[model samples]
Each structure stands twice: as structure tokens, then as C-alpha cells.
Target: MFGIKKFFSKEDPQQTEIIKLLNSYRSAIFPIGVQNEWISSIEKCKSQYRILITLPFAAHSQQKQLEQYLLKNKIKEVAIAIETSIPASYKFKEIKHIVLIASGKGGVGKSTTAVNLALALEQEGAKVGLLDADIYGPSIPSLLGLVDEQPTAKDDKTLNPMQKYGLNTMSIGYLVPAENATVWRGPMASQALNQLLNETDWGELDYLIVDMPPGTGDIQLTMTQKLPASGAVIVTTPQDLALADAQKGIAMFAQVNLPIIGLIENMSYFNCQHCGEKNALFGADGGSELAARHGVPLLAEIPLDIQIREESEKGENLIAQGIKVAEHYVYCAQLLSSMLHLQSAEASSVEITFSDD
Candidate 1:
């Protein structure tokens, strides 16, 4: 039997050891981080050695640390290529990842959570797009203060998605009158949503958040089947009734084999502006218990802040506005992003592709 290095001619002893060292090392972002598994292969050229690494999330620190370690090990003049793989159920030529934001019933601030989450993901270093899938009660146009604004067509067949607050947006409200009701049955609504998703030109999006209509009904089920969703996040209030419905939302995704990223508790509590006190107006630990019951993480507990409402109504997402309320959403965004990367790492295919600059 031949040794592993027998294939490569004049393979440097230090280079082989450095490769081993990289493979054994682990970082916080990837507790089991290493080369060989993450990297495709190491190539030895006359001028420079090249190694390609694919990561579920960007790790600038890890890259720097690895470079420094290689220098210390007397291994210089190496080229490192880093690329990302966002897990998806089905492949979209343009969009890399699609996340479905859902709720069991209406009036749980599902749309608000979806809007802020999209902005937060954009802030967190991903190209994000927002799709308003709620045909009957499309609130995205109103939330973005574009209820009167109309989307133009690139041609007779394609409609240009509207943009606001640095996010590409498509909504039924943009096409039809705000006051007018959708009056769409199941199949019609599903077709309209599919048309919006397929017809709009969302260019090279990292994350396309579909603000699903509230409920575990046809629209939600249809999207799970049609869209190549990376994962889903359920939104609910910190109330028993809301938590019960949220469980159903979790179960719905589970039934369709879509991974549940986590649960977000909207209006978890209220902060008294004057006295500087906290109030669990609905109930405490409801979302937490639901997450525990379903064995999913409780991602965030957003407060019922008036400013969040005011800013949202004014077409300014709190995350974009940089208000104090933005911190919670930002935290949630970070957690969501981290969890997504972790899940993708576990679920992604082993084939690695690299981009060199």
C-alpha cells in the first residue's frame, strides 16, 4: 500500500504537517472546524500553494487566525479561498436561501417580525429580500408606507419588485388597491403567490423572507411544498392561546419536513416608559414552554414597544432606524443567522465549490 503523500511529487514535510494542524483545529463558529472536511484539496504550485474552504457562515477571524498559525508554522506563500453554502431544499438559480416567516393565527405581529428580521439579516451581512405572501391582507405595502406605490413592469411578463429601506420587496398590496380585498380562494391565492415569486426579478438574494399569511392553512402548506425553503421561523405572543397556535405552526412545518429554525415571542412583555418597569401583560414563559415542548429554541422575546409600532408604521423598520428597540431584533438576527449556519452545516451536501479572487 502506498502512503497518502506518495501521489504528490516533492511534497514538503512542513506543508503536510500544516495541513494536519489545520484539520485538527476548531473555532467557536465551528466547534468541529477543520480542513480536509471543509476544504476540497491542497494544491502545490511552483509559486504558491492553494487551498479552498467552504463555510456555512463567514469567519473572518478564523481565516486570520489560520493565516497567522500557518506563518508561525513556517508555512508562508499560501492562498486560501473561502466560499459559502446556504442550505436549501430545492435549488433556485438566483436566490441562495429562502426563509418562511409564519404564524398560527392573525394579529400576532408576524409581518412586523418578518420585516425587521429581513432588515436585520441585511444588517448582518447578507443580501436580503422581502416577499409579502399574504395576498388577502397584504400589509407589507402599508408597513413600508408604499400602499399607494405601484410596482412597474420590466416587460409584459415580468414585474419589477419594489424597493424601500434597502430591501427588495414584492407585495400583493403593490399590485392591487390597499382598500380592496383579495377575495382569492385557495388555488387562486396560491397561483397569485407563485406568480409573484416566479415573475419578480429578485437578483442574487442571500435570503428571501416570505412573510406568510397568518395561519396553518392552504397558503402556508402550498408555500412549503412549492418554495425551496431553507428553514422557517414561527412568531407568536407570550400567551397561552398564541403559544398553542404556535405549536401547530411548528407541527405544520414538521409535517412537511421543513426544519423549524426557532420560535419568536412577539409582544412578550411591555416596558413601562415612565416608571421604567417591565410588565408581562399577556403571560410569561409561554413561548419558552412551547419551544421546550417542541424541542426548538426560543429565539427572542420582543417587547410591545410603542416606538417599534410607530417606526414600523412610518415605513422605517427599527433595525434600519437604529433605535434602541433595534437591539433585541439584532440579537435575534444574530441568533437566527448562527442557527441557520449550524443547521445548514448539518444538512448541506458534502460537495465543495470554491471561488478564487
Candidate 2:
């Protein structure tokens, strides 16, 4: 339904005009991945045209660019709708979507990305939850300023999730002291993660963002097999070492038959506070090249801004304020939301019936 072939079937001259323009229009994420891939659809109401565009990920700048392109082509009184498609392992009753924020190795800013992304989704008008599944290094508590808060027991088997910045959250940090070491074996850690995931009252969430532990080890593998994730977002820096690890992360997900939503190139560059110059601190376009090579979207390239670091350390995510960094997160979240919607639409089209146990 999203390819150029549909437009040829229509007889209207204006339909033909739109089709010609769209043929030249390429998506930043899914460019040339599939032949005749129709990124947008149209519905006519009276004299106006309503176009609905579905993306593999979100980019606000791209949206504006497309609108401008259409306008320049003399398409007037056209309304555009943006949507996304994300793949899922399975659906959960309490949560509509489960997104894993993952990394192949440590020190890639995975936790920080997860925190900001979760808050950004909430800011973009979604009921969001953050799950600190990094058993060894649970940082959501510290990131959201919930280190002093503890969960209330809902029952013998379940605990209530803590609330902050309009997000429902659960973390291992809330259960243990900050300085206490987690001397947990693989099985013990996995069991604890399971309890935190299923034995918590998450209520009804549009998305439950899971901050996965680093590495391509037992914990990561177990979570991929166990969690009902809609998709995963890999976080990596622009350095060669980080990209190499990110490939392993992508491969691990592929091995588990998990779909990748996209890759977030965190700390891609740094902005000079005084001169307003952008310096490629790590490297240039490593993430973009990786996404291009792998046929996945490069969701966002977040700059290494001092404010982003400062606010995150203070448990005040920049996205919660009217900050510039927040805009990137908002676009990323919007793209993710569109992908999730697309995945849901595709899944629903293939209605299946399972035998009741």
C-alpha cells in the first residue's frame, strides 16, 4: 500500500502529479531499501488533500522539508499526517508497547539516552514508563532523582511503580542502597529483572522503556528471549570501538529474531558554548554509515552539550524543559511512535488465533 504502484492505478490528473513528485522523494531512513516504496498515502475530502506519511523512524526536520518540497511543487491546501512502524516479539496486556534501550558495551551513554527518550515520549503526549532493567548498574533512579524513593508493596508478589516527571518507573536502585554492590550471578540477576518486570503495577502504559544492561552476554540474551519487546533502540558513540560493539548488539538482536527500531548516535558531536561551532568529538557519520550498511535508520545524532550532561546528572532531563536538545528527543520519539503504529497495523492485518490453555 505504500509504494508508487497504487498511484498509477488512480485516474485523476492531480493523483498523477502527486505520484510523480513522490517518486523523486526519498526517505532519510528507508531510502532505496525497497523498490517503489510509497512513504505516504492520500485521502481527498472535498477540494483538499490529506496525505498520511508512515516512516520507519521520526525526523521533524525531514517532515518540514517534505512539506516545503510539496508546497514548492504547487500542492496547496494539503494536510500531512505522520506515523511510525515498530516490530514486536509479542504484545503485553498492561503495556501497549515495550521498547528496549540497549548497548553492546558500557560507557556508551545508554542509560542517559533511555532516560531522556522516555521523558521525551511522555512530553510528546504518551503514557510512558521507564524500567531500569540494568540489574548491575541501575541508573534510572539517579537520572530521575528517585534514589531516595522506594516502591510500596502492592501484594506479596507485586510492588508499586514510583512516579516522577509524569512517568511511572521501577528500578533495582529503589530496592537497594546506591553504594551497595550487586554481587549477583546470572540466574539471580535475571530472576530479579523478571520480578521487577512482571511483578510491578505498571498500569496502562503506551510505552514501557527498558534500559537494558550492557554487553552481549547472558543477561542481554535472556532479556531478549523473555521480555515482550516491541523493538530495541541501540545507543552508541561515533567512535570505532563503540560502533563495533553496536554491531554486536545489532547482531545479538537479529540472532534472537528481535527487530531493531533504530540506532541513536549519542555524543555524536560537541557544540562549542562560546563560538557556536560544532566539533566532531568522537568521529563523523560513523552511526550514519552503520545505519546505511545495516539497512536501519539512524534515529538521531545528539550533541555532547554541557547542559544535557549537567541536567542529566542533576536528574533534570533537558527535554522536560524548553531546551534545544529536547527537540531532537521529541523528533526521535515521534519517529518511534510512528514506527510502533506501523508495526501494530501490520500485526493486526495478520490476525491470528491461539489456543487457550
Candidate 3:
């Protein structure tokens, strides 16, 4: 802190000269042969200290003037002479519908709903992609059985998405073994996520379901602002303990101006697989009451089915299991499709229900 406070102890005329020179060329000239190709370009002329730059139309004459001044003031090794120019594109349009599946707290089956809903949407013949934005705990690879595979990139950048269950999937888990990544700070986690969103090959998708990292913090703040999230689905259980956290999560999204597509109360009631009698394990209709109070729909109240757990654990096709759980997920997907108006005349309409399975 001391060093930072006193970094510029005093100014020397020659030192001032160097800074002035670099400052003039900082935006005007760039290192020739730089790896990043998105912005302006610079190329070092053979056998000359002077660098050539393709001037951006932003201020061609101004950039050229600055570059010339730097070359004239070149003190050899102190600063390398380079060139500059605008080459189009410093901004791009973002994806259309990014559905963020989030929870105020973990262990409420948030990721489970995200993964299955993504697949369920895909099953309805919509182009879907899944992004495991859960930097701290990425479970898509494990749940979807993509643990062994890694996402391959074209060239040194631009990753090709990994495919599973008719959905294009990419996760930090696919980049490395699950739970192997160290605790990432806010900035580091954000940087990794930026790479996933900007650099990866998401292509075109009807829905890009982002499995948000639990807790409303830096990650949530970044995604809600940076990504074009159409709406969010908050997953929660009926337990009063979890409800508090879920409310906080909903508030965070609302603060960022994202729509609440409704709430899915997972494990709302437990069904005895043997007895076939339903029991309110946590408390019935708690999520519905919460949704109504918040003015958001109680989209679905999913039962605590053993088959749901078994399928997730075994990495089996969940839809293959004929049950109300599968239908509920499919129904949620249809609701999302309707929200986004993804049902096109060109695309065949597929009826998704329990009986279809």
C-alpha cells in the first residue's frame, strides 16, 4: 500500500518524456505480431524499428500522428515502435434467451432441474445448449455423464461444445476433473466465465440454460448484467430454512431486472415408492404460497421420487423412466418454449407428457 501510494515519488523531465511518448502511442500503436486479432492490427516492418498499423477509421489521422511522434521519440530499448488501426468489432450481440436456473441455497436440486430442463427442451426439438456457470461446483458433466470428455477448441481458441442428451453442453467440469479446481476468487471466476461465454462455440440456440453458482454474489451480479438472460427459474424446496435463501435469490435476480419465469418446488412432497402414498416431507404448498406472494407462478411441484435420484446418480436418460417427474420437467420445458415462443411453423410440434414416455 505504501509503495502504491508513493509509486510516483517525484517527476523527472526525461521520465516524463518517456511516459508522454508511451501515452501518445499507447492507444495509437500496439505491439506488432500481437496474438489477439479482435482489435486493431500492427505489423513490424522488416529490418526497421518503425511498425506499420492499419489505422482504425475511428481517428486514422490522429492515430497516425501519434504513431509518428512515438517513432521519432524512440529511445531504442525503452519502448518498441509499433503500429495501430481499427479493424472493426470491439462489441458483439449476445444470445437471445439465457435461462438462469438458480437457488438462494444449494442442495435444493437446482442443477438437477437445470440439466433435465435443458434436455427436456431439447427433446421437444428446440436447439438447446447448457452452460455450467456454477464455477465453484460444476455438476453438469457428472449428471449428464460427460465427465470423461473434454471440450475441444478450434485453433488455439473457440471451443467446440460437448454434446450429450441432445443438448450442447460445456462446463468448467469438462475442462478438468470435477472438484479438482481450487477455490477461485471473484475476479478469476468471472474471467473463466467470460471465456466460456465469449470464446466458446455456442452457435445458435433456442435456449441457453445457465446453471448458476449458488448464492447471490459476484457471479450472479456479473451474469445478470453481462448475459442477456430472458428470465430465471428459481428452484427451491418447501422447507422454511431453504425458503429464506430462495427469497434472497429471487430478490437478487429481480434487482438485476431478470424476469422470474416461475418457481419449481423440487422435493415438495415425498412419495413412498412401495406404498404409493404421498407425504409432505418438507411442508406442502410452501413454495406455492411463496410464489403467489411474490406474484410468480408455482409452475410445478415435483415429487421426491427415488427414480429421479437413481437416474441422476446413474447418469441414465431420465425421460426414459415413465413417471410424473419426467412429465413435469417436460411440461416446464414447454412453458419455457411458450415464454420464448420457440414453437415455429417450420418445426414439428411434439407433445411432451407422461403418457408420451
Q: Estimate each model's TM-score.
A: 0.76, 0.77, 0.68
The lDDT for every candidate, in the order shown, is 0.79, 0.78, 0.67
Candidate 2 lDDT by residue in tens digits, 4-106: 4564466676756665675566554323321233345677789787777654443333556666677889987667665543333337766878999999889
- What local lDDT score does residue 141 receive in model 3, on the 0 to 100 scale? 86
lDDT of 3 by residue, 148-255 (tens): 788887768899989887788888888866555557778778778788887788776757889988878767788667776767889999999788888998889888
Off by over 4 Å in 1: 1-90, 179-181, 349-357
Candidate number of the best TM-score: 2
Q: Give one clash count per candidate, in the order shown.
A: 0, 10, 4
Comparing 1 with 3 on lDDT, the higher-scoring candidate is 1
- Using lDDT as the measure, name the better of candidate 2 and candidate 3: 2
